[model samples]
Target chain A: MIRTFYGTDTLNSPAAFFIALTIGFFFGLTLERAGFGSSRRLAGIFYFKDMAVLKVMFTALLTAMIGLSFCIGLGVIDPSTEIYFMKTYYGAYIIAGLIFGVGFVMSGWCPGTATVGMASGKLDAVVFLAGSVLGSIFFNELFSIVKPLVTWGQSTQQNMGQEGLAFVYNSLGMSKSAFGFLFTLIAVVCFWGSEYIEQQHSDEIGKTGYFNTPFLRAFSLILMVSAGGLFVLDGSVNAEKHKAVSSSYGLHMSEKALLRDVASAVDHVEPEELADYLSNQDPAVIAVDVRPAKEFNAFHIRGAFNAELPDLPQFVQHHTDKRMIVLYSNGMTHPAQARDSLARMGFRNVYLLTNGLGGFIERCLKPVSLRKEPMPENSIRQINLWRAYFYSFDNARPSVIGSNPSADSAKFSDMPPFLPGFVDADWLAVLMEKPGLKMIDFRDQPEYNTNHISGSYAMSIENFRGVLDGVPSMLMPANVIAARLSLMGIEPVFRFSQKRR
Target chain B: MSSGNQKPYSNPYLAGVFLGVVLLASFLLLGAGLGASSGIARLGAFLSGLILPTHTFSSEYFGAWGEKPLHYYLVFMLLGVFLGGLFSAILSRRVQKSVVEKGNAISSKIRLIYALTGGILVGFASRLAGGCTSGQALTGGALLLTGSLIFLICVFAGGYAAAYFVRRQWHD
Candidate 1:
């Protein structure tokens, strides 16, 4: 795959700089050819006399857009990971645009065109260039004051689970090709509008009738057709292409070698050792939970993604030998199997979590008090810390005594099926959409009928309470609620929501 | 100044296609698009660093580029742009050393002052926006970025509106 030059040493090489210079050369030559070196031609758009600025800019943008979309459709480019998308900061960018526009008309040259103007022996462009440099320095001086504005809308996007950089199509949930087609249509319409405006002004541009030219007609037709082609090439093929590219990194070791390594216990990492790794949040360590999705979602170690045996290759494909990929399940069986597969798939750093989640829970999460023998001070301290880290549920028992990994073995049948928790309305809104999420509303039927969350079953707290042992409104026993939750398919992993007002 | 030997400019649409091809080349080769402001800013940093080493190195914006700010792809690109423009202007016989202003109505001195002020505003604004016309409006616009498109629209609107106030400077 042709990955981007970003983060690559080739970009810092002299040859790369030469390539940049060459690209810029053509960029300048094109600008000059289009009369961008002339302030009058650039400013003509504002006067409604000449629309070259709009015509040229829109055409150039459309041309590139078409090419980029085609590249994406052909599976030659992956815009999401390969290309650097500018982060969206609405407030800062908008204000900057307004200021830039005002400045643009005032100076008649942007940063790119100003260089061209200066080169063409325009003295005022020289002055403008100097002023621009000064302005940059000025901005640097006042960066502290402007920092807030720069970061204003970024946090909002982050809150919405966006990773700073977001594409327009991604935000709208529209396909890239679909968006490209629509954008091309808009550009074509804008071109016509610009031409009409210029014709109204009745300048040289109007007299030229560039819109009626055969070449432009063909160009527009071809552009529209190519943009339309993007729709035919769906995005799924690109994902398949990614998988094909990744699978090229085939099994590195022989089956016998992998078996030998596994037999020697060289690829096993103890649960306690993995706990130490998690505590520090080590970048080099990637913990993968090789369990079924249901069980993984119910409860997995923190920072571990659920992937099956087949998905292990793709899951840790990006990780090199430097990364320690620790795979775990309820026991050593699944992870060991996964480690063998990963080793065959060219991953040398793959390790099975020793004894898996069972060991993690038994040695790390279970309180030190239930041990058959007295533990050392260091072991006790470590156990306590691990317990706090992994099992912080306020009411859920750290472990079920004498149940032998009850959470894993009996599927939380021995423990309360739900952990009472406070979830904000926003969180509930998202949670309501998930499968197997049971929202039992404690509100009265009238209130529930008026406005309750969709799919919520109305039930009052009074229904779960009665005059027990001569006490009025006394809550039922924990076993009763646990039985009810289990009947409702609410596992111990289920978190009972107490919606914040 | 003589316009006798100068050649007429190319068709806007043709030139635009050429520019697009160049930009596409940039994306393929560099994995990034063209820009002019960053190069200029870095040049400024390099020049300033010569005189005031510590101050330039400690500057929030410029210092990030380090002592050798000119050792950047954009800086080389900017140099190429200048050279390419010079070559094109000479070939077309358009390099008549003169002040490019609207008309004779405004003196060159005042026109230069407007140019400086406008340049300063544009420079500052582009940095604040994280990109200039080339970087944001052109590159990001091609990528169909929502923010870049919005910025492009706002720029045109702001330009036309502000043009009214600055009309006197250009009125023939």
Candidate 2:
């Protein structure tokens, strides 16, 4: 029997590396073949110049996905043997996807395609690749600030060994085959729809005299083969890995059961046992204060360490082997929220302080002053805002500490650096002075409204792409920005910082 | 010269079929789906390490990649893709050194600027989204993820919405 290599079980095996390499190679080849190497070709989809990209992508997706499902149904592939699908991190994926898509349309080639394009001799592809590398580096440098969102976004069952699409499907009372069929149907519809749209716009595209090129055809064929090869290699390797691991460790309960047991184990630990564990030196029980910085600072358990809830997983991951991680928040919601988030990220031994911080104070701390004074609504709102700001700042501080000292020192240096996206404020000023300029801030609504640069329109980062609907420039349409500026009764020569740098 | 040099693109349906086979092969062979951004992210992690090793090692996100060398599965996969694309390009005699730009109305400089800016945004956004267009739209969408579907819709909407305004760059 040909063994299947699964993601979960392949980690410790030597074959995993080779499997990963083969999969990666095909993935890259397909992308290049798809003309994803060319910015113009990629952006052409938006302009209705070509829809082959969408069609080819969907067709491939349906083919592989349905095949996997079919294999599972036939018992040729055990669904449980593989790492199940991950839960939707709705907030993170939605926000990130929008930004990424805008970037995709704007940049012309995504990171993978750009690399291929660079190999194929495209200068723009090289520039784009450089930009992505820089951008990712920038992201890491600023991870402290962005850690909350990143951590929150990454939360899922995959981390906990309890999360999987199969569990969710079972909960919904739908068989795997049924869900697969539904999914396949939807994919087919989308493929057909995209094709229909392409046909509708074919005349317009053909008129541009760009569609019938031999170069494009060859690229398409190569892309198709690579894409197909990648799928086959990935599935086979993973399936084999899965078989090997399963044979070694017999059929275990699903990841869901494992996660549930973990959660329950943490929950079942009596308060006395926890207190005993905390008092004991070997079992090291850490009190995790998961509230905003202001709240944590104002009043928290004496021994509790302030690791923001969103950041608890990373903290735990880094400081492994903790006996108990008792997370507390201001109210009831935060403890459960934080606990769930951490659990999803595969952190074991995480517990929600029952009744939260309030409970802890009432039970353990026994504060002398139990003053219940409900502040006015406005004051309460102000306190909340301050707390949020301070919390974010506090959560962000650690990453700064963790990042390379050299990079931080360089930030303090006077020497000019040629960072890809780091535009000088002075240069921005120059661009701002150019005629017909408009600026759109793509930070979150609260962040934008709080202290955006003057004359910049407030477009929330969450729905940044929504503003582009019918506008040009995927980054920020000059015309729309201009119109907004014209409406504001101001005309500038340049559009600076239209979207996030 | 134009006729001799021009290579026709494969039929869309045929291309789609070939691509589908590849996708199926990935499933049967790898037991995992395709993703582009992770590979890019791995690259990012690798570069960050080269530039600032200490910081990259400490980063919760980038640190994951720091556990291994820069050339992982994704990197190799990407390399293979380039080779495959080159192979195809060569076979069709379509390999040429040229800048694919909009009409003469738009300067190469402008296109390059947009491309750079766009690349930066996309890179940042992919990290935010936890994936890119290929990972989310193609892979996840095939899996029938609601978020991916929503993302796919928004992408097309966002693109078309921006198309008309940028018409001067492409259409003019």
Candidate 3:
């Protein structure tokens, strides 16, 4: 992607300041060149003795409008993301315009032209500039009183939730390219009208051949054709791109089918069953962590691919129906919502992690002696396997201390509450003195080379994930990971493979 | 009175096309449009800050920008515009020390008073509208913003209507 300064705080950078200055320079130069430095000429427009302002304004508007449409059509910039579309405060804008218009006629100079006039050493313009500053101070002083008028329609706009750039064409329900074409045609007519009016007011010599310019005619023709080209291109290519941008997330399954699945309780997997599948590294099962990146990075179920809710549909489509897809978050609510939506979307194998990750930690990874009731033999075995695989501790520490395992006796008090699978900065600082600590940096090679903990083995996380059933990043079997670790001259500590960036 | 030394203005259409390209460049590089009132308003705030620092920084209108209101994109833009206009005027020999008004009709003092009054109205209206001719009309109009288009039409309509009342000030 060609990164412009969009969606960044670089606007206040010195570079951006210089760019604005350059743009302003050209703007002022062009305005002065167009005779906008003369207040008499500006006022002449209102008097109908001159129409340069109208002609220039409209021509400029058309040029920029058409150019923008072309840029959007060619995908040089995405308007939906890149452009800062000002909100429509209808009443405030129109009222401001009327007041501003009256002021323009009375002053004979708008803010920009007045600056030029002042530069041309017009004493009246200097007075006008002073008046503008005083006026701003006046507005600031009385802002509380005028606040309602200034934000007249803001509440209604907020209620409508019409946050997109309310372009004229969008409000009119017409495509952008079509609007550009129509606007270009309108400008041609206006230009002709301006010329006619100017000619009528001019002397005999000036009126002789006002419409006889071949260059003007040729330019108008070129503008119209370019607008038409944009129209066609936008309709054919950009329309579909726009559709894809606005996701098709509507449900595909019948309401009855969804309700039946919900009632039958087949939409979720128990923590014990999921643990068993994960412990054996079942190739048919895939766990997707739906939590935000920060939480997932802090601690997540091993072998789970981190994904967002919006991305789930596309990600699920890539898998076969035979693979069991389990979705999970910190709590049951997020996974349950995902399961319901996925089921309605006609995905058959999508299942939620029952009671979410909390359930897995409590029922599947908790020590057998910590349980309130005596657990069955198979459940105990599965829990021990899950604890060892996920926490990387051979039942030596409580996997999750905050959950408060039943019987919080002093026996578990001495164990640090730090998550068993991940070590914090403090833990690493303390462990650095020990000879047994085998640190593996999972960040890229360049980052590892720049600066990393001393004596840590550098390994790319990519080596531990291979394509499984056309889905990338499905963890390789546990034995493969173990073999990779052993080759690096380190005994298999599953936590070492966790991404440490 | 013709100076007999200065060149004529460029064709309006040519000038407009160049201005449009400048506007397009702004959108492409900065992802925003042009403006004049904002810079002037910030200048106002900065000046006010110099006089009464606490009030200027605490007032709802100018306070949002915090201290150093002049440290902004529009402030530099305004400075550039002043310098650019000065350069262009000097080159074209249009730089003259005089008041602009109807020839031999309105006195320079009266014309200056009228200009000041008009400036005040425009400056206040621009702030109320959140933009001015350059920012809202030219920039937003090019983008086809509905509010800006509405503002553009109203400005012309309102100007023509008010011109009747102000005609004596300009017409000889």
Candidate 4:
């Protein structure tokens, strides 16, 4: 990953301060070595004689510019990650430059070089430095007077349409590479021009020239710097590109290692083992029942979190990673899909229950279906014990139908939107005890007699259907059905009453 | 490696390459470049606050940096500038005890007065400009900032225009 410290809490620290000091040391050394410590050399630029200031400054500018261009091209330095560009204040820079220029000729020192000059034991540099500090205080003291002048043409540079030459060149259909090449060309030409002018000036003055470095040394150094810049930036370049692509595809997992993880996650846990975890209240376990609310309310394992299909993402987000998520359903299909989907999304903790809850009931609870193969005597005893606890209530029978089912005793919402035919269990429980209403069970006679809603009339499916070309259909007259319901103490009258305050 | 009584300054181009490497190191390691004017402004704020804390704290300009002026990275860099220059001067035998530099034509008192005036102008202008020569010219100029480039050109123009008037001060 690319590391950049800017616009973040980590940007400032003791370490950053140390780095700044080191760089400043080198900067100061370079300035002093280039004769910036002496104001005479700097001021000679104005006299059109010593072009060292311009020459040295331009060389540094071009080197950095070319180096940065290469860094950007190779994707080593991400400007967006770390670089901060100073806002342009056109009017302020112009006004400030005018003032600074006059000061430059008079004092022969700028702020940074003056410090270096002062170090050289130049008494004038120290005095001038103190005066500059005083001037800074004066500016701040009368800021309200200067604010208007400095703030003029402040916000226009942001658009860059009428400002930066790069924008103009780009808008004219020239690519960045082409522009960079042209820019480098211009810099080289300027470098040559400065050298020619300085040579003429040197001849006129009958003095030694400013630069005396051998051609090969300078040329080789430039090549070596360029190569070093490229080499350093290359490692993070590919990493950044991979990051962009991975994020675009919505995969945060290391794609290279994901297949191995997925291969191992296919291993499933037995229902008996899972029940032991639930009984022991193992905190590492998470049970997710992905079946419809009605089905889940009818019967589901204890401690399972219920969620609709569409609510899976939000549900998982709320309870993820802290434990081993065990997903199961009435069958394996939906649970398997949910587990695989979660795992594909970089969730490593999700697992599937083998054969689902149906297989669990068959293998561990059904007494008659016990396998003939040799089994542990203690395991059999434990299975029978759990069977009594889990399967004692006949969830399929719905013994107290409208009352809370055994799974309803487990945590789950009562109302399932897909089961629009059934009234809410809470509402139906209240209405079952009402005087005028009669609850009906339109199932087989044996099914109703064994277990039904309290005080509900037992009836067959045929009462609500008739033979139409040998196909069962709803053809009963409304009055006939009303009379049948009235005979069972159900009123046909509609109740409409208003309550008074 | 001329360890002698005095040596001429290094080749300007070679010195500049060294400067660029240092600047690049700054960008890579500190996410910043060399600067000076802000340090002086921050010093001003620190000093003014000592005299009139409430006034410095209330005013918009000084108030921004008045509370913790020296906390800035640039202040440390400026300190380094002082130290590094001293170290280089000592090694090169260029450090003098107390030498007043002035043209043969100008009196020491007059030269001192000119230096003070010029320093004041540059100091105030650098703050208004948001950076000095090293900050704006080298750092921002290399970044190809339009305002900085224009400022660099204008500084030269302004200096040339003013030099005609001050020519007598420098004439020997």
Candidate 5:
């Protein structure tokens, strides 16, 4: 089978070397930007003065691993497409890694950093580099003698090598998803542990002002580019698969008819239609409350059957022909959300109570008790018509739109209206024409590789987030975002689309 | 100048990611991951071959190294690494000549000696194993290589163990 470009095939010889050099340069730049070249700064890890290293590394790894696993779970890329570095002399690598780690902590410089140190005019770094070269030569000379011991009694066939943690996980009979979950849990624990350690030794490490350095910034940019490369490669290969999974997941969650906030509510229906349902419903029309049990118990519409969210599927399955399954939530959003989810599982006639329970109370229940003010009637009719139209098509299960089922699935969503604000083909073309707009697509590996908006560089969102400190919240400070963008050659003034949100 | 008194370093997490990407790219373009020792080894082999060709070729260890050309892929990669590092340092205006040793602890001479010794030990250990710390620990660890994990754990353990004895070298 012809595997995609983002995997091992992408790392072939000259390409790999060039990639390494380019990435290395950027990595060095980011390291400097992050203040990595200074030994005292690095020693902060040991003294517990700072824990940026721990936070950034674990987050990056977790993000990438999670994204990778999601892609695998969605079957966008075959898990076995790349060769993981596992077949070598295990004993040798372990011993080497341990020694290297010790050297790292003590000297505050690894092989990579020592060179960067040399570049920054640190004589010690230069000396260290010299030592490394000599060390490598010594190893080469001694290789013949150590070859037998290196191989030991390990099977020769095992030398064929494995790829990623999945092989180890599969060998242990655990599912990839389970392993991914476990790894994430462990990483979170490690993150917490690092923080605790830093807190414990806060005084000794002092306030290390390393966060805003040029070295670190440059280092982050390099990572961003590398991630971009991966994203472009991976996105192109599995864009459709990702779209499919996201849509499917969206649909499944939608069935609960629960809206977390008002924004989601506004996306579906107006308030007046829900008022109409309250006035028109017959006594026999079973109004099922499909929110959480706690929510139902706290306060729900009067005369509503308490059916919890998870139980809705089972309830729908058991009660095939109920008079009218009118699902209501706190707002108009939940009902619309729930309708999609229920429809995916073969449920039909799922209706969102327009205006939700709030609307019903204001429009229908209030009129019976007190003299009510006159309300506009046209808005009520529009709401009813909207609800009726959706309910009619509820049974039409059209194979769940936006779910990519084939390897060769064309990205129909890549069309004009669906283009991301900063990353449309036209926007990219314009940016490319500019001196230095540097459009970066922060998607996953497969999606970017398959077909990114033309001229936009692919960088996995995980990598970008990793190097950028963390994922930027929707309302993050613009300056911080701009600073990050500047590192990637993107202008601070470029308007980014908020549509993806 | 006192290393401890010097400005602190960049965030390691970010650095690690940067390092990972470089390694990834090396794998993609060069069909090999990053290795510091190999570059050093090639240089050593070449130097030894030129200085004492007969002895270098005859020796069990050094002899095998001299068989290969000096300017191999690893040598070029290492050269690029130095250039890249230099470029970044120059651009950032961080280039300044200085000796980096811990503050007011061990004298400069001792620090240099220790650095040399540490380098040699790390170098030997890297050879004993198939790759160096970067290759095995960061790169391999990210890839979830079992040996790499073991190596990373051991490095921490070893460093901590040695740290206590070497406190004089760093602690004020």
Candidate 6:
């Protein structure tokens, strides 16, 4: 398999249906042709009068076994990639198997064979199939009861490499080669035994089942020997060159594309689309109210997810799966600033609402009295709907909180004048993934080691500054900086050629 | 309506070989084994879709396959089985529609009732078993899964024991 789940994903696609139909056509034909379409023939196994079921099942199982073992050795089969296995499920399986077995003997049909019977015009099969479906529905409807029952036997029984017989032999401290040899011997014994039993009943049935002429038998013998030899000679059914690549999942959007997407989203979001997304609770679209926590809790859009600018990076990083994040605030500034920060981080799906709540109310739910003139029918209906949820005609009033001048937000305004090009955590995270960019952590090594963001290199602030000759903190000389960088194998700053500059 | 010149069914060994080849080809080509149970289960869910569409689509068990219940490959295969079986039965003249198939010791009425009862039980049990004869017994057996083999033995043991008690149902 190219990667995990690749096998099933290939089968689950649209074109695989034709292959499924073709495979099914042959599968159905083979089942029906083998006398499996009739319950009397099937039920005969219980009576020991007809050994067809055992012969058929055992033969098929062994055949696939040999074929798969060979394929695995030849690197053509990867068991985990293709074949599916459920958990050990000991409790559920045993009980279910007992009940299914009872049903199998009584009905004389299992689910698969019953389908074949129905196809061959057996009315009983139809009833069985219908009843099975109803039974499934009943199980689902009363899931509360069945959930606990099924989960009781949850245990990991994964065999080493999940190889067929190799697992059992490996568990028993036997080499896979010996297991293969023993496996071949067992299959031969079973084959011979089934033949002996079937031959006893050959006279009653029309067919002798001895399709293996001398040459065919010899050929099959060779095939079996080769299958066994391959398992021993090469290995079990696991991939030889098993390689899994761990991804450093950083979005690698091109600058042009990033600018185009973020620029478009940041400029405007239509009122109707935002309303529709929020109303339907569309999973792909997340609404972020960029307002403060206090304002968000007081009143906000019904389904909008809230986050301030400081916490937006972690929130966005946590939620990144090609989702569109819509940001809105009281006015345009907050959302516009947040969207820009996200855009620098190569996130293309972050959008700023074109207008704030005031614009939304004016455009989406303007009262007829407030309207300059006549309004459209749809607008009138939308206004009425908005009125129902948001407008309590008798008591509707906006909560007013006078601005607190000394609030925490004033800290940003009063910051030192020298720090102009401030990059937030969101932008820095994106820069970390870039090939040529470097993030020098201005913290102690222990602080960096504790839990720094991935891809940040530690560099102490103490190393960059020193007390120079009884003076307070002073920067290192250019020559000292050059020598320090040279020791670390980093290129020192170079002056541009005057003409080129 | 008996066709005197109708071809007999293939030899069991020959048919078994063909079945094995088909099973092997499925593993190689599709990374899956031959199965009919899940197809039927999905069909069951599809039927339930008409009655309880929301519950049918949202229920954790059935909903995993998403909105369309009949979209799985097994369902298509089941249809193919139906078509193939119909074609084979038509070619062999085995398509006579009758309500009963019982032996001399048992009346057709009693056998029919038993058949319906048995059918319901098997249907319900197959879901619980996570598979039926083809899926668990044949496919899992081929894979040599411990659980599948155990289930196989239990099914046979349960069937054999049950058959002893109901010998009259098939005795002729």
Query: Which has the better DockQ: candidate 3, or candidate 5?
Result: 3
Cα DockQ of the candidate 2 complex: 0.24
How would you encode candidate 5's per-residue C-alpha lDDT over A264-314 as one tens digit per residue? 332233334333444465543457777777767645554567787777878
Q: Which digits, one per residue and each the tens of the lDDT, describe model 6 over residues A367-393?
A: 654553234465578777765655443
What is residue A64's positional error in candidate 1, in angstroms?
1.6
Model 2 spans with C-alpha error above 4 angstroms: A1-3, A11-14, A28-35, A151-161, A164-196, A203-501, B1-6, B67-71
Q: How close is candidate 4 to the true structure, as a TM-score?
A: 0.57
Worst 10 residues of 1 chain A by lDDT: A154-163
Candidate 3: count of backbone clashes, pairs at least 3 residues apart or interchain:
0
TM-score of chain A in every predicted structure = 0.51, 0.39, 0.51, 0.42, 0.37, 0.43
Question: Residue A206 in candidate 6 has what lDDT?
Answer: 68
Worst 10 residues of 3 chain A by lDDT: A155-164
Give one digit per residue, the lDDT tens place, for model 4 in B1-172. 2236676788787888888878766665565566888888888888888998877766767665536778877887888888888888877778876666766888878877888999999999998888888788777766666677777887887898898777666666
List, residue by residue over A432-478, the lDDT tens digit for candidate 2: 54444456776444344335678777554333233366753255556
lDDT of 5 by residue, B92-166 (tens): 667777866466967877776666666766677766665665566555555555565566677777776666666
Show pairs that collide, candidate 4: none
What local lDDT does model 5 show for residue A231?
43
The candidates, ranked best first by lDDT, are 3, 1, 4, 6, 2, 5
Q: Where does model 1 exceed 4 Å of error? A: A7-9, A155-162, A204-207, A235-501
The sequence of per-residue lDDT tens digits that candidate 3 reaches over residues A217-279 is: 987898799788876887767555444334323346556556645644677787767888887
* DockQ of the two-chain complex in candidate 6: 0.27
Error at A264, model 3, angstroms: 37
Rank by TM-score, descending? Answer: 3, 1, 6, 4, 2, 5
Q: What is the per-residue lDDT of model 3 for residues B3-82, given as tens digits with 9 covering 90 to 100?
A: 67997788888899999999888888777888889999998999998999877776767776657788888777777788
* lDDT of model number 4: 0.69
